[model samples]
Target: MLEFVVCFTVVAILGGLLLQRLWHYRAEAERAAVQMVIANIRSALEIKVAQANLPDGSLDFTFLTEENPLNLLKVKPVNYAGEWYRPSGADIGAGNWCFDRADKTLLYLLNNVNSFEDSQTKLLKFKVKLTRLPHSPAKPSGAPETLGVAFEQVKD
Candidate 1:
């Protein structure tokens, strides 16, 4: 009887540890998804700047999902938290983006960042920034001479 009890206790402890690890993995996966979205957006912008020769590349929030020169639209269009990145028309909901033509900067703002995580105390906000530089004729074309993008998480 004592042997059976010890085995049950060990099983319970292992199960609890597994569950905790599972949650951690889920949170990490969520973070990675968000990072992927930012990377794709940055890549598209870089291509557009080089190929299209866009001086400023100022675009609206809807441009991220629009089909054309950049073609960044996804069929599902869902973020990590299973949320829709709607167009910035009358609503301008989650996953909104803006590009400044004058400053050559692109900014993405996502709402309800904490919803992606299990802990209530882990409040976060995601901001993606892209900057474009002036490319000269003397520069090479192997890399992006005109643009760069960065992503950051903010505590809110």
Candidate 2:
């Protein structure tokens, strides 16, 4: 009778521990997913930069405009006619991107630009950013092998 009671107690404790671990993992997975989305955005930009083979070997600002020679590399058209991006059903496509020429501090307009802690947290977050260099490399082959190292620091 004593052994039976001890076994039940052990099982109950183990079950509680498992449930706790599962809950913690669920939250962590969600955070990781959000991070992945941010990471992908950076990677896609790098891919495009690589496609634009510059004369001096660095990605030029000219590649960013409508006259971008590597238009085929863009998922979302680099040069559109007269239309901004259409919003997805759940605001997935609603994002803004801008660059500061003076400071070179590119500002990615995120959907949920929270100022510290706020009560209004959404189900998902959207964001974008600019990746640039000091003076543009003398030659940028735009190779994945070349750009992969820059992003590796941010990935899990």
Model 2 ranges off by over 4 Å: 1-3, 53-124, 130-156
- Cα deviation at 126, candidate 2, in Å, is 3.4
lDDT of 1: 0.48
lDDT of 1 by residue, 1-156 (tens): 999999999999999999988867765665666566657766765565454445565543334323221134343235322223332322333454443333233333444444364434322334445556577888888855455444344344
Per-candidate total of colliding backbone pairs: 0, 4
lDDT of candidate model 2 versus the reference = 0.41
Q: What is the overall TM-score of model 2 with all chains considered together? A: 0.39
Point out where model 1 deviates above 4 Å: 54-71, 74-76, 80-156
Clashing pairs in 2: 50-142, 56-138, 57-139, 57-140
